[model samples]
Target chain A: MKTIKDIAALAKVSIGTVDRVIHNRSGVSKKTKERIEKIIQEHGFQINKTARILALNKKYNIAVLMPTVESSSDFWYLPKKGIEKASEEFEMHRISVNYFHFDPLNLNSFKDVFDKLLENSFNAVLLAPIFLNEAKERLIYLDQRKIPYVFINAELEGANNISYIGQHSFDSGALAAKLMSLLINTEDDILIVKVRRDNVHHSTIEDRISGFKSYFNTRKTPIQIHEVILPKIKDQETINTLLHKKLTNHQIKGLFIPSSKVSVVANYVEEHKLKHLKLIGYDLNEENVHLIKNETIDFLIDQDAFFQGYEGTKTLFNFIINNVVPPKNRYLPIKLLTKENVKYL
Target chain B: MKTIKDIAALAKVSIGTVDRVIHNRSGVSKKTKERIEKIIQEHGFQINKTARILALNKKYNIAVLMPTVESSSDFWYLPKKGIEKASEEFEMHRISVNYFHFDPLNLNSFKDVFDKLLENSFNAVLLAPIFLNEAKERLIYLDQRKIPYVFINAELEGANNISYIGQHSFDSGALAAKLMSLLINTEDDILIVKVRRDNVHHSTIEDRISGFKSYFNTRKTPIQIHEVILPKIKDQETINTLLHKKLTNHQIKGLFIPSSKVSVVANYVEEHKLKHLKLIGYDLNEENVHLIKNETIDFLIDQDAFFQGYEGTKTLFNFIINNVVPPKNRYLPIKLLTKENVKYL
Candidate 1:
């Protein structure tokens, strides 16, 4: 372990200049900083993390922008809990997290919350870039300011993100297909149910559908895949009627709902006494978990939203403080949750 | 945020005495220790962990006893790597780990290793109690000496283990059965293969078998199941011959191997051109991972052996240093890995 004094002597610089360069303070000249960094790298000099952070004694403020947790569906709450956990653990390191929430359904609310978030000064940002276009435009400010940002649940295409911590949507979809293939026989047809208010689908859902079809493409015998894009996500009666109409015409043996709104389909399946249909969906929302426990849902693909949020925040902090560069895309394991294994997850 | 001074003042004791009690050093009187402990607990005083560990400046030695890694099968190497990772992370805390390996096949080698491990002074122990009776006897010596220990892969029924961090064998079996059920239709028959040298099966193997059976018991129409216990684990020809003899008599659609020797059966299955058979097995050993990649195995139930070893070491260190009492049994999640999701896992 080489000391700072040793590096300073080798670089022919004062210890204070070396310290400033190490901590990324602006006092040292560019050439001196580069020379000191090269020497440190050459010797593989490692600093004591806790002691170094204490010596610097700089407070970091992280801005977290995400969708508000709706009372009806507590999906967002899981990530919030994970972020809070990270916040609590990092408090001793002088890291504080300030959260700004927006309505996921309302684009105006997203803009308003993002504007409010930009008004405040933060060392870095952790966000779920839901509205892609709006998020892309607003992220330009972060790039201009040279503030590092991490994406949690969703990501902007070709954006300058430090890391994207979430599921590989397409891979998860393929996994769901594999599970569904096992659940139903080769002769059985499957239905891809999408319940949302708008016709324009998110890239994640579209990618999942594509991934699902890609899996079936590898099969020897082609199985029929039907898609039902319902306009009403929250209106259970309308969803039930739409699903009922689709089921009557086609003999769908397995149902693949590629969204957190899986509990709705599970409810419909349970109410209709569709014992032959094996349902696979996403997320471990309260209702989804309950349905899984009751065996209404055969499988729930857990994206590990909690880990995405937790790791996203930690990634930003580590990058800003320790200069640890995370992978461009950090995919959480595509966890398959059933009645037998859901509790452990 | 209560400090040591506040705790000492509350207990009417010197800061040194409070420190002794906090570090569990033999200096404070019994009554004074109890008084200081009560005050600290009542006030919810949390000492700064890193600073406290630095103040103690005590080097902890942990003895790890497990099976030696055989060159032919690097199954044990995964856990060893995990332990080494933990060892590297905790080096700053002055925690050192000493490894002692035993031949898992031979009882005398286990005894010899145990004797050698007992010769050294260690603060704590982490072990995989493979030979139940022999391990039980040696663990008593550690109990008498009052050294805390944690179990990694397996557990003794009535041992005083501080914590057991591993897969719940029975639950993993149940999870495997669940996955197998999804893979095969109701008409398909399954085979449970046990590839081991001994006739008397370990409790973990038996538990997995029970869990596998228990899962089928819940189904409306029970599927026929056959068993094949081979004499040699390493003899590929004998395993293939025995499996061929068994498969000729029955229409086994799905195969479930309770142990990590699933790779052997996978090899046999592939050689025999058992394309209709859906195989499920345990662990991510090198061969098994390759087979999974090539699509010879349908599903692999990952026990997360690496996490088990890593967490066991961490549990012992935390219990000894931070006084954190881990749960009696910490079950790692039952992971279902397939060709699609294996890469992410």
Candidate 2:
């Protein structure tokens, strides 16, 4: 029930000084700011976010930089839907989002999109740092320009981002391994399928593989694990031959696909009428969901990419408008989906 | 960019009428409201929620009615934490929540709490309709009094509640059964344990058992299933005797506890040194979580009771302030947790 005036009076500071401290404005000295904050905390004083937003009446522009939906196996499409939903909700507050797409394969395309985004004076940015080196440089420039950004779906190490909303790739991979272990016997060997494509986000996939291996390492009786890297997923005959070779050579009972391109291998399994082979993969894309429904895929570790984009945008806006500091890493729940539980999710 | 005045002029209605329609006030005619809404939708006109809330400047009192945290195996404790979180967040908006607790053992206690809540002038209500018949009568009374209520943790059939935010009991059980099937061989039999206590929430437990049975029924190789109803969980000797008899009489490789009181059976298993038996149960309570961490419990079907309480409270507040109509049944994701994924969750 305490007001700003009460906080200022208690702290022996001017109302303007208290206001600056409340808004996280950098005018007040550290000592004065601490005193005012102490009083506010002691009294449980709340800054009226609704009134503050109404008073500012400022329009904010947010730039979204990520690969196009068509750029990476339609995985970005789910997050795009989530972004649009957030856009519709936040539009009431005069917040507008402009999207910039880059091709995941081409470094030139990534650079061009970053440059185009830099041309605009945006209040904030939400991006997936898929191209590590290029994204790091762009992020430094953004920091110099004093524009806050949120990283979605991908994290760039040591970047000055307000928040990174995504999954813990390594933990998710470990979770997938746990589920896979439950499906197959200890003696039965497992295959880790890496469906290669141009511009594949390698760090996430590699972390997942590491996590999967870590889980098995902890087990008393370590199961035999094999890896098969397919050069390109588009060629059906080539994929069939590669997978056929692995299955025949080893007593493989389960397939663990580390990326959203799980449908490619799922299609191979279905076409070859491979029975009793438990398939576990990532994402809940249209094709992945269909494969899961038909029992081609047994378990899926959903990163909830939709929530990453949606929460990333919302977090950026809250920081810009309300001076709310978000957690540096907002690791979403590693959701495990089967056909029975998929419908509810 | 369309203003209220523009909407008013375009709808051929007065600005006051348009305002009333937007606020869902009863004074505006249905036809006029629809016409104004049509124009607003066509132009994608957004009503600034922040400005409207600031303008209203009304303090809302929400009444939360549920069993005490100590009632029924400490399952309500998780949701209580979630409710407190929502309370802290919404306190900034002059929205206050008052909690009313009832003893789960006594129906009279539930009636007494409802009566006490009815005396207060609450803008909204959030409750768990654990006592079905009693809740139905109270819900009818609330409908007559025109106070919106959100159901959390439990649902009443055919009630005029604004939203029911919780897990689908049947589906969660089915999901649990799927996990159990993966853990044990098809030839191995399973035991369903029901820990009995006074004022047990029978509906949820029954639905879960039905869901578990349904899953096995769908399988081509039907596994033998047995049920054990422990009269009370306090006496370790009694629990040990009953479980010993079942395990000795059958080829049981898995134990499915259909309630939050899974720790009782988990403790029995640990004490008896029953190895290679998969223990799958419900909830993320302190004891269950501890059991899972030590590898005593294999899999947990998390209802996410925290989210249920959190979303239930938020939904009620949005309905009261922003006139947001929530989906009647907000079925949360049936989350499966193990030692590997439990930390991340």
Can you give the DockQ of every candidate in the order shown? 0.58, 0.54
Fill in the DockQ of model 1: 0.58
lDDT of 2 by residue, B173-220 (tens): 888899889888888999999876545455677778999999999885
The local lDDT score (0 to 100) that residue B141 gets in candidate 1 is 85
lDDT of 1 by residue, A1-345 (tens): 477789889999998887776545566776787688778767755566677667448899999999888664567888988888888877777888899998766678888999999988999999988778788889988877778899988856799787899988898899898888878878888999986554553667777888888989977546889989777667878988889988985568989999888888888889989888899999998899999999999989888888887888888877777655566788889988888888886
State every prediction's TM-score relative to the real structure.
0.80, 0.74
TM-score top scorer: 1
**Over the stretch B1-345, how does candidate 1's per-residue lDDT look in tens digits?**
478888888999898888766555566787887687677657756666787667458889999999898764566887888888888877777888999998765668888999999988899999988777778889988877778889887767788777788878888888898888877878888999987655543666777888999999877556899999887776778887899988985568899998788888999889878888889988888899899999999888887877877888888877677654466788889888889888887
Q: Write the per-residue lDDT of candidate 2 for residues A1-345, one digit (tens) a residue.
A: 477788888888888888776655567887887677666656766557677767459888999998888643488887888888888887877888899998655668888999999988998999988767778877877877778889988777888787788888788888888888888898889999987554545557778899998889888555899999887766888988999999895588989999887898999889889967999999988889999989999988888888888888888877777655566788888888998889888
Give the 10-residue window scoring lowest on summed lDDT in candidate 1 chain B: B195-204
C-alpha lDDT (0 to 100) for residue A307 of candidate 2: 87
Clash pairs (backbone) in predicted model 2: none
